[model samples]
Target: MTDIHQDPGAATRQEPGATSRRVIQEFWRLRWVAVAVALVGSFVYWPIIDNFRVSLTHQDIFTGETSPAGLENYRRLTEDPVIGLALWNNLAYAVISVLFQVFGAFLLAAIIEGLGSPRARAFWRAVYFIPSAISTTVTGLLFYFIYQPGMGLMDGVLQGLGLGAWSRVWLGDPDTAIYAIIAMSQWQGFGYAALLFSVAIQKIPAELYDAARMDGAGALRQIWSITLPMTREMTGLMVIITVTGAFQVFNEVMVMTGGGPNNASQVLGTWLYEQGFNQNDMGYAAAIGSLIFAVTMACGLAQLWLNARRRVT
Candidate 1:
């Protein structure tokens, strides 16, 4: 016997099998939603994978045909001087940019964390992070114009300060162009780094700092020996993120220099773009893409390995 409320069909009782059948019917009606999603993915997902397969093969520029050429494209990537330059330049960029980003962001984040009040902390955080919100395209354009030779903003400002000799064509000069790109990347990247550090710092209990102070450690020593050590994992993570971004540098280069000034700022991303689109060397570009993917995975694995080593000790 069942309660009246539980017996939907009831003068007295309703069968559990009948209730289960209704539930199953409802589930069947809703199951179309899942099927539709799967059907949509079925149409698009296979083609994306097939295109990746085709990109690994040679493509005919004139006839628009493709054929498998195995690993020859990868061999060519090693032999090509331009590709070599691009790879070297990109590697350098990753090392230099990550160094700057980690040091600069960590310094700034630490200072912000030390501020006496919560509101002041937030205000400065916003001030520093505002530059990162703008599109890389717009930031590149703005800097490009600023660095434009005689009448540009940077030039004019330097000239007004009676330092006209100091103002050269910033983007046009080979020596200065990659540095200019780094400046832009740093501006965009520091915010995210700061945010990560800030979150980590906030999570660190204030009692830890207080205890360090009680042990006769001055603020500087406390930060150097305590705060920095405590936050090492976060630092490692931020370095990895910054390094990845440096290798993936593209938007600013595309908008500003297009790997110009004689490949002075040429990076792997733009090189890949040129290989796939301009040169129509899709297979080789796929090799480059694969190389980048492998390197990125390696960095992540390396970070994990170091973290595990730290935990073991």
Candidate 2:
């Protein structure tokens, strides 16, 4: 019998090589993730940080001079009456959008989904969604012409229906300008919202409805007990999106009323544009942008919290 012995240090020497290979593999794996993080930090997070920095200082466009303004811009935001009007206008947009786009669209979707004929359901969906597919600029311009005081179709129809006394310059009058713009937005937006609600409704199990029916549930009962609860997530999402979009509204107001008739139709987005580009107040504009960011972020955090709560429960 012959005794064979292996060098004990050989195993220890190979362990270091194995460890080195693992370290290299892990480095390679994380290299791609590092690239993504770097890109996002540069494009997304850096801009946000830079915007805050810019908000603290005033920049002159023509003179190309930059000066620190501290909180003066934000102080002006508190005193600026136009800012108050813009906030009110955005609030109206959010409230009306929630009413029509969220609740109303959900009802519309339920009704459309309830129809027996597939063709009818498809037809109605297409009709409603058509307006959403149209360009906002084109839609704004189209509504602008339609809202013209004397020559527009709206006034003409009022006159033809013997309701001429009820007609006002839809886009010209300060009292009605923002509302008119809001109405146009609702008309263009509700269809898309309805389509989303319809998709959510479709995802619901038919067995739930069948079970409800067997339990003596009517259409309204089924909707209340089954549909509403099932689509709660979708409804929450729509509310957040609608409110955010309302605050960010710019194009339609810009194209239709130009925030005119005394800036009655100005929303946060348009107000920011007016401050930065038109009025040449970059610092003030940055502050408005920060406010918008805060609001949208709050909505996003609310959504996250709701989702977490739902999961926990």
Q: Point to the candidate with the largest lDDT.
A: 2
Model 2 CA RMSD to the hidden true structure, in angstroms:
4.4
* Model 1, residue 267: C-alpha shift (Å): 0.8
lDDT of each: 0.79, 0.90
Instruction: Compose the digit string of candidate 1's lDDT tens values, residues 1-313.
Output: 8755555546657676988998999988888798787877788666555555755699867788888887788788779787777777778778877776787787788889999999999999998888888988888888888788996898999989999988877888888887778777777778877877888778777898899889988878877876687788888887777667667778888888999888887888898888888988877877777767667778878877887677412
Clashes of each: 0, 0
- Tens digits of per-residue lDDT, candidate 2, 1-313, equal 8989888888567654788899999998998799899999999999999988888999887898889999988888899899889989998999999999999999999999999999999999999999999988999999988888899989999999999998998988999999999999999999999999999999998999999999999999988888888888888889889988988888889988889888878888899998999988898999998888887788778876886676412
For candidate 2, give the lDDT of residue 191: 98
- Model 2 is weakest, by summed lDDT over 10 consecutive residues, at 304-313
Model 1 clashes, total count: 0
The candidate scoring highest on TM-score is 2
- Those runs of model 2 whose alpha carbons end farther than 4 Å from true positions after fitting are 1-28, 307-313
